[model samples]
Target: MKKTLILLSALTLMVSCMSKEEKMKEAEADGNEAIAVKSKLIEGAGKALQEQGKAAAKSASKGVGDVIKGINSGMSESISQSDVIPEASFKANFEECKAEKIYASNDDKVKKVTIYLIAKNDFKGDLILKAFNADKKEIGRSRLKADIKKDDAQYVDFTFDERTHLLQTEYFTIK
Candidate 1:
């Protein structure tokens, strides 16, 4: 029973490191890949228990899953680190950006566009902001803070200089 608990606990830890998309794929894949991943985790845990002399008290059972809610919250707060943009961040250029009144004043000067996202509290996934042109040209984008409220998950700030072009935007929610 101890061995069984240890094996399952270790598998949980390893699987925790995988992204949700990968997990979905694993679930959809044939049993082979699943078994391999499971086997690897079990073997690793057994080794740790032996070498660490039981000092390996970090139970896989109490890993990221136990505090998943908090861990994701922490991840959201740590989103601006350049390498961790939630997959839900992007910009799409579309039509409204050329709607006469808005575009008439838009020249060609583009200073910069920062795209990001802020996850709504309790919201399953991150919010998405996209910018599109009249021809659906992806112009620019930026996500809000990772830890933003749903009511505040919206960011459509389009900035330009004398060198930017008329850019339209389309916003969507992604979970």
Candidate 2:
């Protein structure tokens, strides 16, 4: 009977030790899985933050470029306006026709002249515009078709070639 009791006690101890070992192994496996999941989450969060930063930087760069373009445009306009000389003379070679307004428009490396005319007689012909410098030297010339009614007004635009120095004109004549 004593031998039987000892044998049963040994069997119970062995079973308990095996159960504890299995439980420990399961806990270790769960811990490893949790660590792997945490690593993936961290990596995903880092990638998301990096993408946001890139987008923000790109937007800021575009905004700065637009501002610079606006400033350059403003400066060019101011410089062009200051270069024009007021009190420029304009002569019309038609009877009872008066030169009303003359203005110079500047473009990229070129200049254009616009003339407003008022007449009391019906006229239809090709109008020749000649621009001269302060020294009376002819600098530019352009021809445009004009059709003016009696007691009415007309606007004529003369576009000169790129080589013409129309921007430095001091006087002009229309015939």
Candidate 3:
């Protein structure tokens, strides 16, 4: 009976001592597995961020392109016309004043009509400009006060505040 008890004690001591090494090895394996999972998660997150950045850049590029197209179309819609409709007041001063150049143009969506005149007599009054469409309907009007002497050349600018976007000003009149 004493020999049996000694044998059981030795067996228990051996098992207890071996369990420490086994536990250490298992813990090391668990740590390596956790590191691998973390590395995979980081790589996946990096890939997702890269894809998101690429998509954002593509969308911004498209937005800029659309804005450029809009600007180009707006620029193409600008107008410049030299045709002028003669009125009775204009004919009465034909010998005293000569209309050299007359044109209407648009800049930044604003309409501007200009008239270059050579005066052969002394004049001091307001110059009125009336813009019209194809049907001869008055669309806009502008007035400028000016004082001029004989044999003087002057440039007059008239700006339209309303209906600035319409390029249908086929003709205009001066008074």
Candidate 4:
């Protein structure tokens, strides 16, 4: 028993001692260094969940933009009958506003529509929310009402039947 205890003691000593706190601190330091390196390599990757989120956001933004462009171009090519759609300008503006402004979505499942827009005071301007069906017919319209000062953000929300909504457009003007 004494010899066995002695062997066990030797093995324990051979495995260097590190407190949990100390190990965690060292790990955190290494993690910070890794984050710095990754930031330099991918730029925006260092944001919060450095590994998963930033890339996803950038990719999604690009994809959505491309889709919107395609839609606008397609619309302009076939929409000669409509004098109201600003075709080119509106397409660019929609993507730009989406990238610049932060908006939230509220879904009306029963109505089969999702309304997304910058809320009242998102900007010192009149914000228009327009919903269209797949047939390119207007289904709903609302103007955001709120007092927003310079550099202030706004919360916008609207609801319609999800089934009826096909393409949504937002128009904003600064007053």
Candidate 5:
């Protein structure tokens, strides 16, 4: 028993006194293993982030597409329901003192009227617009101000109940 114990202690001492090169080689192997594990973890995290970015971009693109479709549908509906009125130009002078018929729609389908006036010279006064139906009955009237310099243009817009046939204009002094 005494001889066996002595031999085991000698073997343990020899192992504890291993060469410096051998110990260094073992430590380097452990470091290489740890680095490989860390590299795999980093690669996995990068892949997850890339997938999340792709998903977010796809969702945002879908949202923008939906908004554009809604706007286009609304615009199409409005254009299909409204009627197109022809543009008309009229000229008026203070000395003429005549009521000019600017526009006269053949049918009773007129819903809105727009009148444009270009000042021949410097003039600051009022203009009266009268709307008549097919039966020659006054339906609507509006007053517009011509506070414009020479060669400048002014617009007068009128919206009525359902229909108008004729739009006449006459110039009057500012009171």
Candidate 6:
């Protein structure tokens, strides 16, 4: 009876020390279950975020569309063809001069036009003023010798009464 008890104990110990193949299979089953649970959680989170993103995008698109529509309506009402009269007055730093439209009288009987220039620095150049009619045709032109000191403002006048309604002015360095 004692021998039978020892044999039973040895058998239990052997069973407890399982084979490598059986241990590997058990570990694989546990790993696969963990991976499946993690995958399910990740998929659920991703779907929830995707739905939120879609809703946000739809709301943002509607807001942008409303703003664009408002701008278009405002522009169409404010800017008409008849309101596009020739511009008047231009002031800027005169370094490296360029031609610029000054004023539009829209009156063919305008006898005199004046251009005002303020010299931030001492300047000596030829200032040219040109007048045009409603048809964009040049009607009169005048050139003036400019010799101005800093902080000086001068007016260059042109006698123009030949159906000229628009004025453009430019300046060039005199060599």
TM-score of each: 0.22, 0.40, 0.45, 0.26, 0.29, 0.30
Give the number of the best model, judged by lDDT: 3
TM-score head-to-head 5 vs 6, winner: 6
- For model 2, residues 14-117, the per-residue Cα lDDT tens digits are 87675777989999999999999999998998898798978988999999999999999886544332222222222232342322223344446445666667
**How well is each residue in 1-175 modelled by candidate 5, as lDDT tens digits?**
9999999999999888868998899999999999999999999988987989789888999999999999998865443222222123224332212232233354754444455555666777665555544454566655566677777766555444443333321121111
Indicate which candidate wins on TM-score: 3
What order do candidates take by TM-score, descending? 3, 2, 6, 5, 4, 1
TM-score preference between candidates 2 and 5, better one: 2
- lDDT, residue 14, candidate 2: 88
What is the C-alpha local distance difference test score of each model? 0.44, 0.66, 0.69, 0.48, 0.55, 0.57
How many backbone overlaps does candidate 1 show? 26
Please, what's the RMSD in Å of model 6? 15.9
- What local lDDT score does residue 155 receive in model 2, on the 0 to 100 scale? 64
Alpha-carbon deviation at 38 in model 1, angstroms: 99
Q: Can you write out model 3's per-residue Cα lDDT over 1-175, one digit (the tens) per residue?
A: 9999999999988876757779899999999999999999999988997989789889999999999999886664344444666567654543333222233443455556666667757778877877777797888888888787777777777777746433677667777
Task: Give the distance in Å from residue 7's predicted Cα in candidate 2 to where it truly belongs.
Answer: 99
Clashes of each: 26, 0, 0, 10, 0, 0
Clashing pairs in 3: none
Instruction: Write the number of the candidate with greater lDDT, choosing between 2 and 4.
Output: 2
Give the lDDT of residue 102 in candidate 3.
30
Summarize candidate 6's per-residue lDDT along 1-175 as a digit string, tens digits.
9999999999999989979999999999999999999999999989997989789889999999999999997764333111112222223333222232333345645445444566667777765555444555555665667788888876655555454433331121211
Residue 31 CA error for candidate 6 (Å)? 99
